[model samples]
Target: MGYGKRALGGVSALALLAWAGAVHAQDEVTQVEELTVTARRQTENLQDVPAAVSAFGANSLYEDQVETVGDLQSHVPNLSLHVGDASNAVVYIRGVGQIDSISFNDPGVGVYLDDVYMGRVQGSFLDVIDPQQIEVLRGPRGTLYGRNTIGGALKFTSARPTNEVEGYLDATLGNYDDRRFKAVLGGPIASDVLLGKVAFAASRRDGYTKNLLTGEDDGDKDTIAGRISLLFRPTSDFSAYLTLDASRNSPDASRTPHRETPIYSVNTGALRPVIADPDVVEATYNDLEKLKTRGAALTLQYDRGPFTFKSITAYREMEYRTHLDLDSSPDESFGIYDFEDQDQTSQELQVLYKGERLSAVAGLFYFKENDETFAGLVGPDFFVILPGPTYFPFPANTSGLRLAENTSAAAYAQLDYKLTDRASVTVGARYTYEEKWTDNRGEWFDPAVAPSAEDMERLFRTGAGFNVTGFEAEEDWSSFTPKVAFNYQLSDDVLTYVSASKGFKSGGFNGRNTAAAQSFDPETQWSYEAGLKTELAERRVRLNLAAFYQDYKNLQLSRFAADPATGNFVAVFDNAGRANMYGLETELTAVVTPKFRIEANGAYLHSEYDEYIDGGVDISDQRHLVNAPKWSGRLSASYDLDLGDAGELTFTGGVSYRSKTYLTVSSSEVLAQDGYALLDASVVWSQPGGPWSVVVSGRNLTDERYREHAFDLTDSPGVQLGYYGAPRTYSVNVRYRF
Candidate 1:
């Protein structure tokens, strides 16, 4: 996306903070609730954290109808998430992130469950599974949580097993034949010594798109996930937790009407759109995806007075496969069959101590992984051997495979010292070392296309026709990240802090790509931030504001291009250039009356390439990073009432807005989306503190049509690829608790 100099929308986005306070004053109020989060590696009140953080409480999640981590974009400012294909996704925080879904490159945004790192973008579409809380920490996080975290981090905490018998059953039925069933059942296996919990979640829906040629439903949904957790506490000082999880997701896929998002044909110099409206598609192959994953984690903690020692060990594996018609046409001109297999294991040991004047946490971490990928493409049918002669037909079927092994280790320590009762200083650093070994091979052959030796003699001698190259290579990268901060209490009700941190993402061998671009160098970023957290109006209102500036270097860039001879797909990677981003964010929560509450979040961002050179072309200042919007915001309100004898009723509503955003750094005029708005609301009815309840919720209530991804089909210029956001969806959920 080209970086156009447009208005930043700073004034209007920030105005939400003031507007919310004024609107709520005309009504009654409720008390602002305290939210605790693990943003700092230790449990602490959200209002006490010095960094920029947005925490979702169990109640907030239900009231706001937040389903998955991706849904948080509507409620959290400065954070963005979207997916193009099943395995193609990106997460951006403050204009910094990764868009390459290649198996070789790890995500810039770190995903963690109970402190266990999830390093891949594939299979990261996590659904809330009896979760107690979710926290999103904005900005670079390296001192405490190392790994590929230059954008930020996402933390999810599931409810642990409890001795008391408790769980819930949830069911939902929606339009488009959507049906969902979920259950959480658990209790004490042995009263005080052991507790266990098991959960099952499943959802299925009919496709919304009608296939014009095949008369089949496209874009359906089929997903199921289950988890089992156990907690053991034989002694007061020793506690342990073991968890096993597995999930399978197969969501139907569909493309938007070509007319809605047209692409230009270089040959004709005309715009072409395949079809329009009702999501009608003519495809020669299935554009569906299937993903499966399994994981196990064991956590052990030992505490002695003011000192605690902890160990976390985890193993995870994922398998993903997909088939798509690259041309988006009914012709068998081009298509792909992609398969990916990945497995990883990690271990961490840490020690924590709290003294009268100092507090510290030190840890060591180890991570290892084995990943493999295979990409198949139907090459163009007509091709002439070099020297340009009459077109000769060849098999034209091409495929490539990359098998890799990765090892990573890190050691880190953080310490906090008190200068006074109201002032403190903190320092931390982590050193990480990583290495990757990869074996690559390629094949271009088809007995069906062209099986003549007369066509192979000259070409094969020149290393051109049906060429196959195999090689193995290794690369290693290391970095030291550090952070420092100072906090001061301006008053009993307010705290202000300033912090700076450095973060980096390790290099790796690019999977499913050309050997020449097989590896890249590590990328690094430095960020400085200042923030204030306050409790105004006698603790009835809460407001937190922060500003940050970041500088990035050696940003890895990935894109798709066609092989000159066969017109086969190739994923190319390069340590392109640098970028600078700065932004301001604010969050507000106020209780206007005993029965009413209002919350607001907003951000204004400015991002641009400081030095970006693409294909020996200086594109700096011309292209903007993907997912970075000049302004974004969300406002929400809730009201609760007690029906003395009948039941309790609650009403909630929210509206979110995002400014225009480019789909990619090489965004064309057609690859950008204008600012848009989304409306959501929910009504809850239940007996006061009862075990049964019903919720009626609606999302995208306005039914706005927007593009989720606007991809340039480099291999096919006549047609562009686009993914559309879901339209208005409503669901009636009934729940029962034990």
Candidate 2:
């Protein structure tokens, strides 16, 4: 049987087991714990929410070893998070996302820290430090999250200051020289009036890939992060919260690409073979990837009667610099260096009302941002000699700078009204106005007149060597998104909901292209969904299922295409006409015994372009969505054995599978990842209500080889490149909790 068939059969068996467990749960008395979420701007039971949401608490995160945001995709249905480079994380949900990570381009899925939105993907792959909860809201979230949430949204909430002292300390040692330390503490500062919390984490690891030229390790990890939170309450109805967080990442370049094909020289008309190895690369340029991110947020709230007024203000900044070898060769056939700086400020005012039969939330928001980037690229010699003709110059090397400024304002409101004892309806809408201004300047360099090292470094730092100004343009856009939902209680333990919503991702100029300032229209989506949530036998078993259909228009796509003026491969963005997507998702959790538990989730997705036109050619039938797979699932279990005097021992195991996936919009075979599965296991020993614990964990136990990101440059440079995932590894962790 094929890999796809085998994966499907395994997932089917797991689903069957979950179903059987649900049936048996009808006679059991043990209960599964309930999860609370704030997906709709209000705290409520996860099963009672009208939308599809995945929530993970601190314990769950630790059990799954979710150290970073990228670790979340394996547990979610129809979700993909690909870390293409050191800091660029391409995120997709339900077959909707953007592939590019330029500063000007917007993301389909929004990432939020606390209540503040992260403006760029350059730092969206945040480390999980002292986390309270993390929530993934699937589908469009335009009603509450007004900008760039056409696909979905992710929310990370940290632990807050409390009146009582609480904290934990953990140290970990693993293979590949992995070392990690983390500490978190929270306590009262002044009786019940002031409270404070602080968290710190430091992690370092050696790279998995080896650089043959420099004898250095690539794909490494080194980072330090800290966060502080304070809460001041002078009265029972008024409160203030302040949060500050910062992180610094300095690691050896980890995006070491391996060549999939030999280099085809356009000038020599011959192929140059490369070393055929996935774990080794020959690159002369090896630089440290440096990224720094910091943010601050302040929230104030006042309550009167049944109405509460709140205000949130925040500021965030990020700086990133990196050098990458695109050709993965000893010589600098194709390389790139980038320096980016960005900052943003936002303000939000909200009023919430809670009543016997009606609940409502209304908000006004404003955001402003400034971003600048300087980039340089080195390409192979582009001069060619024809029969009985002199050589002609074809400049492919380029240096450029782009500066962008954006501002937005929005007004939103959502209300839920109870019609009968078992029925409720929700209505919400948001209106947003946005404007953007951009300055693009760049010039192609002739190989015959190569610049000096000092000049090249100056251009990379200040973007001053460019001789041509591409364009300066300003654009404004407005959108009105709305949502409606109906929820019904079928039984004491069953809830059903149907919803329809519209969302849009903002449009922008091509930040990498210097020939012209081009703009694409905003991509929009209208989704209709139905969901069922059930609990049986005193909540011993919980099952949630959802089905959705989406009408996607003006789908945004990004690819490396030839520049019209210089014939150089540069990142470009455009829009496809239309597409349709439909999918089914199911999640089950059963507490079969007091010490045994099982969790299973699966997704089935089907997507097709209804109308796609590329350069006057109709190719909708030949194209597929990027980073989307037909089937994805995960099954995990845990069991605990009691020890009389010592502690309890727990054993946990999990397996996750994904079908074939295309990483680029072109759906090139060289950029596709085949069906694959990953296995993980862990053993933990702890005393009941004790402070000490030990955990031994192993990931990718089978040593599976897979590609997380791939670039198809064969058409331009005659070589394809791929970035492989991590191999098998194990770690030992010691923890102390108070």
Candidate 3:
């Protein structure tokens, strides 16, 4: 809760909005429009695009109730979505990411759909019921987005199935036992030759953390989804579209709650009281996580009346499995059990051309991944005897295994030129190639002898049998990234920009707990950005501001140790020696009088560590940059009256804040969370020609206890473990349209 007190509270909220100079007349009475984006590959207008993007159409995520993609970290701007435990999640932007949860590893933000390419990270936690837009391409998009992008890229677009018939349906009920459902259905099966759509969604929840040693209930969840599409238009030069999507996630019974331990008794000065074990239903450290995803896509279009051609083909498959309980200490002698499984495949090809000022794009990408894991060390086998006697034993066999394979290919291009009438310029490039291979098979068993030929030749000699060992290697890499941007339009709703970019992420093999075949390099970035997009006053306000600086190289770091010769406990993956990040982002919107509206967003980051090395000591890089958060903000408001004959009545509210982060970036003994502000309110009542609608929401209206990641243990400094956030809840929704 201290980064100089959230950078002096964001500089006193920008000096109270510059002493309220009517805040530019609240963007000149809210006329703000124009915000189309494709991030430099056509379709401009996000202040003409020079990078540092952020968009969320689909009616502003259904008026900001944003149901997934982890709710866009409460209105993005420096984004974050840590959420570990139960299938883990780590998505930091600006300060990079990945803390370890191996699955052909690679994520520092990169997720696409509609241009397909979702290579794990649980496929970016789906469930957004249907989208027509969602783009968040900030910094380093590696020239037209081809590799990892350091910390950027999240795109999704879906909504195409028209030739008449429309669709809608939504339902929800909440407060812990929550339930949700969604539906969509589209038109024509053969009116001018085919067009169709289908969509479905389901959700169920029942836990909200409360396993104080098993008093039961601890964040449970379940989900299901489906999608289908088809479209074919013949004549006037070609058109085609096909899509299929699927999802399932069943396994999440989140837990990690324990605190209460105090005792003092030296024969007389006594004080002791400790109890916790409400019939332990589950949580000797719990585990559960199962996931599934499927995909297929095809899009083709051609126009020939002055050039217009496009093609997109995609195939994706993802499967995930998790069972973990890496000790949150419910004391089953401090448990440990873990598992992982993954599969991936991808291919992309693109082409685009638009005239009337020049626009061009080109692409080819292919990816493949096969990951398999069976991490080991699952509890109980005990022995302990004391008091003038000694005996300590516990060993029941096989404790390690990891296998991996990864492959990649890429080529990309972009161009945009419109040197007059508001000037514009963009150029891009991308070329990538990657390969990785790993195999580590080491197992030990001796509950009292049975295997020995020198322990089976030290478990097939690759790193020759554990205990402070290392290496089982194979690696390959190649790279090229380039970008440039410039835009200017000093009128017609102003815009100005500047940019520079380069980003990439690819490098693998850690095979859990290191046996030292190390190999990690390919974490690069070089970004510099500047921006301003405005539409003030008479345009109903809309403003965007951006500033960035990045220069991070080979920064991957992941460490956790305890291997005084295989007492087993090692998780090492390293490559960190340079870092530097800077940021400032702002967004504002107003429609201040069309029945009232308002929006605000903010971010301010500043990271460090220009070189660090630990345990062979070097450490001095100012620390604290793991989950980066220096300041974050969000605000929202809405109102629409006029209920004559119950026609309309709407109200909405929002607030969000973040500051205080570091779940481990080589420690600062700081997990001081304590900067929380969340409030969401809603109410809607409508009726104006009947399609039906109703809404009632109340999320986290001051039921904040906040703690999303915190940890410490060096023999337990009073044992701290965390992950809690999600309290006040309430919901009721209904919608319909045929």
Candidate 4:
């Protein structure tokens, strides 16, 4: 069936809500639930916050089937997530984000786990476990969220330990031999003085993409994760919380790149004929990937009168290894092996005060990070192979090692003052200083042609291959960011606010450069935003709207291209001169009746580069911003059916849509993703006042095929690759509570 017809099915779900309204009376209208959030480092009502924020509670998360952080993009407007590898994924909010993933590069969007910042993006694709709430803040959070928040921030708040004993166990079964198990428990450890909580999860699934050659799958998953939390209360005014988490993913199946046809060779200036069928997964080489992550954090707080003192300390580590076959053919034309290790430590101190007409927060922060990486590539020496019975031997090899260390210190303060009964103003600023040091080296060798007598010794040597070049460099940077906002209450049910903010990302040396260690300048943004939060229809409907405009300078950009000499891909970094971004977002929720609900949200964005010069030539007109879709939206509906003593049944269904998206800066038609839509539905049955429940869910019911990411190398090595999104899947879950 056509996709247009499938989309109409989603519209039919919303039409059902109209029929439900006819059966219910006007007096049966239900009120929307109130939400509380910590967007500005303080607890406040969601309607009272003077910014653009979207939040999902525990119940909402479950209904949406949010298994991992990547799933959140479907429900949030103007947000995108692209999986580049097994261990890492790139996140974009509005139209700003980083594209390259390496040891030295930082993420544009910041992610926090229980108020602790995560330093590396490698482990950001975490599994959601017993989460209490998740919040996505749009625009630049310069004052309260620290550095690298030019795009926005994502906050994950997990359920804390309580004095009461409570827990749940869940099991799931699905197609493709999918199996999952999860357990969570919380109770008092030592009377009223201590409390603890523990959670563990294990999941495995067979791959869905069939390999025509090996008769096996190529996209399987296997993972295990656990978390532990402890809370201590020594006095009425003092408390401490400690948390530890660990996860490991070692999947046997890996992604098989789908080769785009009609690719030409750079060596002989001729078309490279397709070696295998382009329809199915026919890669001749097997790929491997392993990732491990660990983290620990401690928070201490003391309350006295109208002030609260807080301290937080955290440490985290991650290790990843991968082997990839780039050519997708039996001929070892291009292969990649990479190893990465990263660790970080951080400390933060804060003081908060609340008064009759004035409220304020002040804090100091420190962070240190160390990381090392080893990358090697093997390919053909001559970059060409004759036809027939000739067997070409691979002789070219290149390797590199990169080591970097960074230290950062910052101080920030924000204050909110009320000038009248319904009017207030907020002002805040932060100053950050950072120092970075890097050591990079590379070597190139051909066993039969180079001086290296032993091929094994050359492969094992540290810092050996792009002509044996090495460099060491150190640099420091400082920035001061600030924000101001004015808020006013139009009535008891309406609020309006306007704000201006500035944010910046630190600069760093490129870790993959074969010659001199090249450096890129920092990027900065100035943003202006206006928002309105309102409750209408006698408190039965809620609507929120926001508009934003951002001006950016020294925009950092990364590009990957194949090198004909070694037949390997190389990444290069540079600064785009200027850019502008503007967007509009709106969210609406309506409780039509006591047992029916409908929700809708959408975003419209426009982005363009003001100036871009590469190799002393202007290229601004040909480049497009990556991960920026012109339009995105979602629509959903849910209904409840009460069966008296039997129990209750809830039904939910939704569809998410995205316009055309560019995967690279060049705006190449071969790497752009067309408009697409996905449909999901779920049904749940629960026993009233009981501890048992069952849920049946289906995702991508329309079976739409979409591209999540793509790599364009048609000019140099003449290879274009595409990575597809997941196919249709279904599962059934059972849960027991105590």
Top-scoring candidate (TM-score): 2
Model 2 TM-score is 0.94
Cα lDDT over the full model 4:
0.78
Global lDDT of each candidate? 0.75, 0.81, 0.67, 0.78
Q: lDDT per residue, candidate 3, 213-249, as tens digits?
A: 5576765778888899898997768988899988887
Over 4 Å off, model 2: 1-29, 265-270, 380-396, 445-454, 457-467, 563-567
Per-residue error (Å), model 4, residue 629: 0.5
Model 1 stretches astray by more than 4 angstroms: 1-29, 251-272, 379-395, 447-465, 515-517, 562-570, 715-718
TM-score of 1: 0.90
Model 4 Cα RMSD, 1 decimal = 4.7
- How would the candidate models be sorted by lDDT, starting from the highest? 2, 4, 1, 3
Residue-wise C-alpha lDDT for candidate 2, range 605-634, written one tens digit per residue: 999999889889989999988888999988
TM-score of 3: 0.34
Q: Which candidate number maximizes lDDT?
A: 2
Error of 2 at 233 (Å): 1.3
lDDT (10s digit) by residue, model 1, range 1-738: 000001111233234345445644433434467778878777778877789988876656655556677778766778888665555547889877788666878888898887889867887868777887888889988878889888899888888878789999999898878798889999899887899999899988877567677887766778899999999999989999999999998876533233334533323334446576636665655665788989999999999988989999999999987766655555444456667899999999999987888888899999999988876665443222322322233335566677889899999999988899899899999999999888877666553542322222213324453668667889899999999999998898799999999998988776665445467889999999999999776555677889999998988877666556655344667776888989889787766566666677889899888888876888886887788989898877767777887787888777888999887556655657889998888888887667888889998999987866665654432345666677788999898988
